[model samples]
Target: MGSFHAMHIETRVTGFIEENCYLVSNPDTQEVVVIDPGDDAADLAARLRGQNFKVVAYLLTHGHVDHISALADLCADFPAPIHIHPADAAWCFTEQNAILGLYPAPRKPDCPLVDATEGMVFELAGASWTVLETPGHTPGCICWKLDAANALFAGDTLFRDSAGRTDLPGGNPRALTQSLRKLAALPDDLRVFSGHGELTTIGREKRENFFMQF
Candidate 1:
């Protein structure tokens, strides 16, 4: 749980993979930002309605099965544009993305798919949002930065004492290293909301995460 001024943030560990889904909402405005609705579409949807959240947008940190498996399902009920990097948008919901036993291919939502370009800005939950394109785990991987909270929504790119593996499809160790360098340059006080595991700070990762050091 976190707060962006009066807005509320709830983290739901969903699906078998335990991907973190973030619901950032401003109760006064009834507007919410849905980040990486990986799995458990039913529960995710229920939680939103239960809280009277009006989803303003669906932001994808990247287009991995564990990160976006529930996107299509959620979009069906909540009509909002989906924002993802063009690189990931190219092949995210195809049959090629299907995992043998872990996940099935995700369907393309009927709603709009906007290219979440680097440095693109947005206003949601009464906070300023910046899109940082960090391609490593996937070509279209991105980290959402919330200036109000000084938080980085790192989706499988940088983790606690670890970084996202580049051995997966479209993974690139070199690109990941470059991305980490970019994050390392940010303010040490910025809170890191990792895609998995416990939360950490940029300063802590710079000292403890070997990948960040490299």
Candidate 2:
């Protein structure tokens, strides 16, 4: 077994709206990935210090304000490369200009944007995660698939009962519907780890998620 045999991948729901920030690490390697450090920078950093996990990279599921408020703070302390899809990258530093006008906290990005490409893979805890573009809630929204853990880190594109609103800038109702269709087709056994709210499974969503209904 690898160091991550019993790895502690904790998820903290921070910010006023309860955005999810995931800390994934491999104890053996002491390396970790921080996903969506939306708020409470000091608190998040403290948690990292306690775990002694060296943050290797910062992953943004989208550029929405609630999902990126603590980005600068995370970048400052970890100094890890920031990765995001190019579509919504410009909104990172300019909340006032966000198409949705819902950027809760605005801060500039420390490094240039990192493109989330198809087939692009990143390793964590000796396992791999594949990035899948699933736009609708945002033009650059992405879902990270951790097949080893049978988890899908879905951003605002998907939820438990309903789907993300396409009323915001760059949001397309038709596109969102199409994206939902794609997600609906995934294996029912895959665990659906959303950016907000409670955790669910693809099977549960398929059967009860009204938005994903065919």
Top TM-score prediction, candidate number: 1
lDDT of 1 by residue, 52-158 (tens): 88999999999988888888889999989998999999999898799898999998988899888899998766778899999999999999998777789999999
Q: What are the clash counts of all predictions, listed in order?
A: 0, 0
Clashing pairs in 1: none
TM-score per prediction, in order, is 0.96, 0.91
What is candidate 2's lDDT per residue for 12-88, written digit by digit as tens?
A: 99977798888877777788878888888899989888878888878888888888888887777777877789888
Q: Which stretches of model 2 miss by more than 4 angstroms? A: 1-7, 97-105
TM-score result, candidate 1: 0.96
